[model samples]
Target chain A: AQSVTQPDIHITVSEGASLELRCNYSYGATPYLFWYVQSPGQGLQLLLKYFSGDTLVQGIKGFEAEFKRSQSSFNLRKPSVHWSDAAEYFCALPSGAGSYQLTFGKGTKLSVIP
Target chain B: EAGVTQFPSHSVIEKGQTVTLRCDPISGHDNLYWYRRVMGKEIKFLLHFVKESKQDESGMPNNRFLAERTGGTYSTLKVQPAELEDSGVYFCASSPLPSGLAGVLSSYEQYFGPGTRLTVT
Candidate 1:
């Protein structure tokens, strides 16, 4: 079965610190990957995505993710954490080829400290 | 352009009652999707719609749930005799029809709604 995994349930960081959220997928072949963020009372927003070329993909809100095929990982990262960055992050992949349904990870909640 | 929108951001209902959730996708999008995330669980796909037709409903949990996209415009999902375990945040998403170009990633991107939080007491 294909699955998306975000090992950390929660992560905390001080403002201005670097941030990294891990994501790994198990699949027979490379699948389209994405990262999304859900702020409190807000809809899930697409942060970044990886397909075919350019392993490193940049997204909105100063976030970027690199797709590593050998590791089967597409981890999200930010150079500096903002208090506003505190939100739940999810990793996802399309259900199958030519399909629009997404299979998402459990998500990791990020808490920022002053 | 406006994103996907779901009605009744939050709803609290009795276990045996029926509730209908509506989703209005972006004006020109031909693909709409439904997903749910129960407490402490990953978000899961419930179904997909291509215009007015049901493209795939393999993920629907049971027969008690019925979905429709009349006129290929907006969609409605109704759960009859809702169960306690049915409580979750339901999300609606929309995307443009894929152009059939294998490597074009933009065509597959989905815009999501805020999600309706359903609480069955």
Candidate 2:
């Protein structure tokens, strides 16, 4: 089974500071990796996804993630984050065939401090 | 175009009661999926439907959970005799084409719904 792991459970960053959320995955074959964000009591919104080519994939809201096959990781980054960026970030693996589900991480809660 | 739509944004029911959650996928999408997130846990796969057919339902927790997509346009997930463990957010997703095993084996994206939160008290 494919799985995604987000090492950071909680992260606090000063407003306008850089942000990086680490993600690791375990899969027999190369997996489809993604980053999603969810506000409190809200539905998830896709931040970005890495399919093929371009080791670094850019996503909505100034979010970007780099896929490193050597390390089996896809870490999300933002040059400078805003207060609006504060939310729960999830790293996910795509489940195969049946349902084509996106296996999510426990999620990293991002807190932006002013 | 409208995004995925899910009904009853929040539902609170007593344990052992019944609850049904509905999802309307984006128009023209052929693939629809159901996933659940138990509190503090990873979002787990529930089932997948391809034009009213169950492609894979391997992740369904147990017999208590039932999901149906009668017309292949909309879907419903019913939890009967709900248990405390069933409390969590249920998400629906759809894609123009079924993101087959090859897609996962290769790469593709799945659009998501807002999610229906369920509380079994």
Candidate 3:
């Protein structure tokens, strides 16, 4: 069985400070990873994704994620946090033989303080 | 160039009542998926449809749930006699199928719609 784990339930950070959201995945083979965010009253937006090649992948909204194969992790990171970045972040991976349906973690709620 | 769209942003129904949710995927996207997030739980996959046919439905909870995509465009999901446990946010997403062409950039990144929040009292 494949699963995604987001250890931090909630994280509070000061605006302009660095931020990191940890994610761990369990899969039999090389996994396709993604990071999504949902702001208050908004739909889920793709932050970044890792399919192959470079371990480091950049995404929209100044977000980036690193895919560490040895650690089975794909953690999201940002150098400077913004107030608008406060939202629920989810770590997800494809579940079935095809990479169409995704299995998401319980999500980490980020709170940015001014 | 509209992204995926869902209808009835929020709905409240009795435990034994029925509710239907709709989703319209992006133009030319052949792969559509349904997912749900219950209170305090991770988002779970419900099913997948490739055009007008269901590709996989292993994630569907029970027979009370029915999903249909007519003419391979818009789709509808109906939960008959909704239960209290069915209260959650239902999400619909779509992505283009792989074209098998080199340099075509066949990415599987799914575009999500604003989920329908269903509350069964």
Candidate 4:
């Protein structure tokens, strides 16, 4: 079965600092990847996704992710962090070929410090 | 436009009790999915429904769980004699069916609801 791994369980970054959350997947082929964010009292919101084409993909809230096929990683990055950006981040991929169900990582909890 | 909505934002019940969670998907969405996240674990898929039909239910944990979507507009998930292990955040999401060729796969975004938090004492 395909699975996603988020190496960081929690991270703290100062406001205005750059941020990057790592995600790795184990699959036979290049699979579609996604990053989702969950605010304190909100539902999961999609940050971005990588299907095919350019390795870099941009998403909502000024977030971007780079898909590195060699590393089996699709890491989420932001040039500068904001206090509002603190939340739990999840990395996900399809359950299987042609399946819409998603398999997610354990997630990384991000905290912003002023 | 309204996003996916779930009823009973939070529920607390004793073991051996029953509880039902409801979800209302976005208007005109054909695909609905259920997922659960146990405390400290990854969110896992529970099932998928395609217009009142169960497309895939391989993720359902066991027989104690029942899900129904009679008219395809709203869905209900019931847990009979809920167990302590059933405590988790249950999420419902919806998306439109692929629009391209029948067999080809197209990427469609899934909009999620605010999730129902279940706690079994």
**Candidate 3 residue-wise lDDT, B5-67, digit = tens:** 999999999999999999999999988999999989999899999999999998999999999
lDDT of 1 at B59: 87
Best model number under lDDT: 4
Q: Give lDDT tens digits, candidate 2, residues A8-37.
A: 999999999999999999877767788989
Query: How many clashes does each candidate structure show, in the order listed?
Result: 0, 0, 0, 0
lDDT of each residue in A53-95, candidate 3, tens digit only: 9999999999999999899999999999999999999999988
Number of the candidate with higher DockQ, 2 or 3: 3
Residue pair clashes in candidate 2: none
Better of 2 and 4 by lDDT: 4
lDDT of each: 0.92, 0.87, 0.92, 0.94
Between candidates 2 and 4, the DockQ winner = 4
The deviation in Å at residue B99 for candidate 4 is 0.9
Tell me which of candidates 2 and 3 scores higher on TM-score.
Answer: 3
Residues B1-121, candidate 4: write the lDDT tens digits: 9999998999999999999999999998889999999999999999999999999999999999999998988999999989999999999999888776732343357789999999999
Local accuracy of candidate 1 as per-residue lDDT tens digits, A8-75: 99999999999999999987788999999999999999998887799999999999999999999999
* Local error of candidate 1 at residue A45 (angstroms): 0.4
Ranking of models by lDDT: 4, 3, 1, 2
Task: Report the Cα lDDT for candidate 2.
Answer: 0.87
